[model samples]
Each structure stands twice: as structure tokens, then as C-alpha cells.
Target: MGYPQVSAREQIIPSRVPTDAKANALEIGPERTVIEITHVGVTAEGRAVKVTIAVAPVHYLTAGYELRSPDTRRSQTDDHASR
Candidate 1:
């Protein structure tokens, strides 16, 4: 959690990940290369919040894999989850 703080707009809902990484794709799934942490609480200003953070090794994502957009990767995850 050494990362920077999220703005107010990002404090409530979880994002529609697999997040896009531009030219660098983020690969996640059976390899378990991605790690996510979620926290649900109230902000100091008293707004309810839920947050999720995703962590991955840059070396593996940018390494040898054929890069694909998160839109493409999201479906793969959804397909697997449906099974």
C-alpha cells in the first residue's frame, strides 16, 4: 500500500478491470501472476467506500507474452469463470 492515494471519485466502486495497459498488456489468471486486495470502509469525511488494488510483476507482463487489450483479456477470465 505504498502507492499514492486515490481521488474522491475512485473511492467507492471497484473498477471494470482487467485494466488496460496501453501497449503493455496485463496478463492475469491461472498463473496467479496478479494479486488483488480489497478494502471496504468509510473515508475520513464519512463516505462509504470499497477499494480494490491489483498488483503484478512488470517483467512477466512485458516479457514474452503476446500483448492484448484488457477488453480482450476480460472475456477470457469471464469465460473461465462461467465454467
Candidate 2:
């Protein structure tokens, strides 16, 4: 099998996502977007690989107002797992 040809614009993955994840969410066009996986495979030693056969645009919104309520106290949720 041959590797699929990906365009320069389609190759850019956002920085907020972890490198090990098979797929990631990206914010485009002023909304939250999800990119679904078309195919995924694993090697003999248990290493995983992913392939994106197609992409479609979907619109989503976040409950930012509820998560960022002024009355609620903000706390650090990051556990310093990577850093």
C-alpha cells in the first residue's frame, strides 16, 4: 500500500493536543471542530498508527460561560503529568 498524499493546509495539527493521540480536535471557523478517524492500525510490538482517509467540517460549541462562571472559584486542574 502507498501513503496517502496530504496537502500542506491539511497537515497542520494544533499544539494543544498530545502527540500520542490518534486524532484531535481543532478549532476552525470560530467554532469547535472534531476530526474523526477513518482508519487506525497497530504494529507487531503494539505501536499504534492512524490514517485519515477523509475530512468533513462539523460545527460545535462549548459551554464556556458555565465553565468560566465568575461566581465559581478557579483552580489549577493540571497535575503536572507531562511537565
Candidate 3:
């Protein structure tokens, strides 16, 4: 059996929320927080194939946030067919 190839990796970070309009300050201080994210890809045989790590501010951990690798096989096939 073969493991699926990783096509691309994407990371999304949240924007800082403004605490004061005139002072132009963020609600969450970057120095006060750390967000560590890990992405592990496993093969069908239950073996670890790849691992990814990312670090960001705590405020970036908002809802709907995700880190992942999207399959590029489908897009590759589509490109060949279009040609």
C-alpha cells in the first residue's frame, strides 16, 4: 500500500481585535499568548508519514480555525484533462 502524497499545506491565523480606537491597541497581547498547532498525517497501514507544526498568538485560536493539507491529486487530474 502507498501513502497519499501531500499536495499543499495551509495555515490560517486570526486577526487582532482592536481594544481602543484612539489608542489603536489590540485586545489580546501577542507577548501574553502562544498557540501551538500540530498536524500529523498517517498512512492506511497506521504509520506516521508526516508532521507539521505552527505557532501563533493565542488570539488566533478563534472558532472555525483549521490547519490542514488538502489533497492535490484531484486538481492534478483536472489539469491533465483540460489540456
Candidate 4:
């Protein structure tokens, strides 16, 4: 493939608080939710092979984790799936 396709992507993949649905998450801020500006780049050279890029956000150090219990972790997982 040579620059044939560009897929649709969602801007805001919202995350809610474990206990409350109305609360905002620490990872994604309320002010930075909407993307005000964007920059796009294209390859100067045409490629023959297809390109698939997979990206994930991993947090190595969270500010608050001492307060979370084992049950809380389970609830957060459950809440994430249900929402």
C-alpha cells in the first residue's frame, strides 16, 4: 500500500471516576479535552509497504495510589467496562 487510507479516530475517549460517573479523571483534564489545534505530516517519499501504528498511554508513576485497596482496583476495572 502507498498512502491509500487514513482511518477515523475519536477525539475524546472519556474516563469517569470509579465511584462517581459525574467526576472527571486525573489523566485527562477538563480544559484539555477538546483539541484546539492539530498538525499533520506526510512522508516525503512514497512507500510500497503498509504501516500500522499502535499506541497506548501507560502511567508508570501515579500521584495517588496509597489510598486504593484491592477492591477499589476491581471496582475501577468494572466501572471502566460498564461505562
- Best-performing candidate as measured by lDDT: 3
| Candidate 4 deviant stretches above 4 angstroms | 1-67
> lDDT of each structure?
0.46, 0.36, 0.53, 0.36
Candidate 2 stretches greater than 4 Å from native: 1-28, 53-55, 59-83
TM-score winner between 2 and 4, please give it: 2
Q: Per-residue lDDT of 1-83 in model 3, one digit per residue for the tens?
A: 56874443345443333224312333445344455556677656556678786655564465574554346767887899999
State which candidate, 1 or 2, has the greater TM-score.
1
lDDT of 1 by residue, 1-83 (tens): 53343323322222233344522455443333343334444556656565555455433333233556879879999999999
Let me know the TM-score candidate 3 reaches against the reference structure: 0.39
Clashing pairs in 3: none
- Tell me each candidate's TM-score: 0.22, 0.21, 0.39, 0.20
Question: Can you give the lDDT of residue 71 in candidate 2?
Answer: 38
In angstroms, give how far residue 20 of model 4 lies from its true place: 56
Model 4 lDDT per residue over 1-83, tens place: 54643322223223222222211433443333222112232344533234333222222222232354779889999999999
* lDDT, residue 14, candidate 4: 35
lDDT of 2 by residue, 1-83 (tens): 63443221224332232223223433244334444324444455444444454443433322232235433433333334335
All-Cα superposition RMSD per candidate: 17.0, 16.2, 10.0, 18.6
Q: Is candidate 3 or candidate 4 better by lDDT?
A: 3
For candidate 2, give the lDDT of residue 6: 29
